[model samples]
Target: MSGGCAVTLDDLTVALRALRLLAVDFPHLPAPDVDVSPVFPEWLRLSLHDTSCESLSAFEQWRTALRIAPEAVDSRTQSGGRTRVLKAEGQFAGAVIVLTAYADEPAADRAPAGQAGGVR
Candidate 1:
């Protein structure tokens, strides 16, 4: 296999192992949205949609379970800063795995129409 193909295989293996671990360790968490593209086979992303509180809690727990450092935690916004996603990156079996968790929408965005009082 080409080097990229081998790395992709490794990434898939790591992602499956991580998912199995999370299923066993954090059964209450909903299944994440798994994504892997042939174009970017070196990385894997598992995204969870949960309340920020719940997502943050799970992120910490998963990182601890994976033995990833607490300092790995980070965050970024999407939808022009209206959506925030908590993120952590770690390696399993030498393959990069990224865990991202975010709520369906920001609290302010979820406010009843016209309640938050901002222009559309």
Candidate 2:
């Protein structure tokens, strides 16, 4: 974890504040699936799964809210052409926040449950 910020109580506080902002600022969107890692460089990952347009829009909104540079965003198609993921990273009050969204694909192309679903 070299070059990573050390996790601290302050980082958790920042994460909570960000969550609150999401709730208040974007009420139309569904609750995001969230993940918090307490290891070095503590991070919070928020994700949504829906139509490509919706997810992509959510990603854009979050990236703007977090003030992440547009150059930081990255997108790639999955191996099977079932879905694509767009990701971006930013720092908020010493906490790393990662925003991701999965674009939906045809139901028949999806993998079985408990298998290689998507990036976690």
Candidate 3:
């Protein structure tokens, strides 16, 4: 909340337009299951290559360069791994959601190979 572009009218407008303009190349299959909670945040972290959720907005912005959110949801596909997409600018985090066909499995709860589920 203290870092990155403050959520403002201009910023929100800019954010939404960016989202609408992106071409994420989602799979063609019907989006199986979408969960906007835990899934979304994890997606942002992975896409942005960040260990902490603190830098998510920057991740979102970075995604803009690559093209990428404020929502923390889950999307599950039949074979494609679960992919997370961010919903930025409060409105998006709560409003718009995009879906693609390809999906694997939800890696949200998967622990490191040798670590226990709750170890981290």
Candidate 4:
């Protein structure tokens, strides 16, 4: 494999591992598969069919896109002062996408408060 392809594969592996961990934390949700392909302009593709129709869906889509195009590192500032960093895999001019998946905060944290009847 080319150097760029190697980087892409590494990125995919990292993202997939992350996703698997996220799945353990959030067992109710289905984690998307990370796909890396040179056919689509050296971009990686992340995809999930069943998920919430709100911001979580959007994040899933973005995460998939970022994983595939791991070279485009971007930061997304979410609510509750949470920040997500999407990192790319290869160098500029020969970068490739790396797709990944993560469970949303709401899905991950089963209980926001330590006691019963706490706010979500």
Instruction: Judging by TM-score against the true structure, name the best candidate.
Output: 2
For model 3, the stretches where C-alpha displacement exceeds 4 angstroms are: 1-6, 23-114, 117-120
lDDT of 4 by residue, 9-115 (tens): 55444434544544565455445455644344344444433223343454445545334343354433233423232333432224443433232343443333343
In order of listing, the candidates' clash counts read: 0, 0, 23, 12
- Which residue ranges in model 2 land beyond 4 Å of their true spot? 1-14, 21-30, 105-120
Q: Give all TM-scores, in the order shown.
A: 0.58, 0.64, 0.21, 0.26
TM-score of decoy 1: 0.58
Supply the global lDDT for candidate 4.
Answer: 0.41
Residue 105 local lDDT, model 1 = 57
Q: Candidate 2: lDDT over CA atoms? A: 0.72
lDDT of 2 by residue, 28-106 (tens): 6656788765553356788977875687787787788778998888866564556878888998656678889888666
Worst 10 residues of 1 by lDDT: 111-120
Ten residues in a row with the worst lDDT in model 3?
41-50
**Cα RMSDs, all models:** 5.9, 6.5, 13.3, 13.2
- Model 1 agreement with the true structure over 24-53: per-residue lDDT tens digits: 876765566778655555466777677555
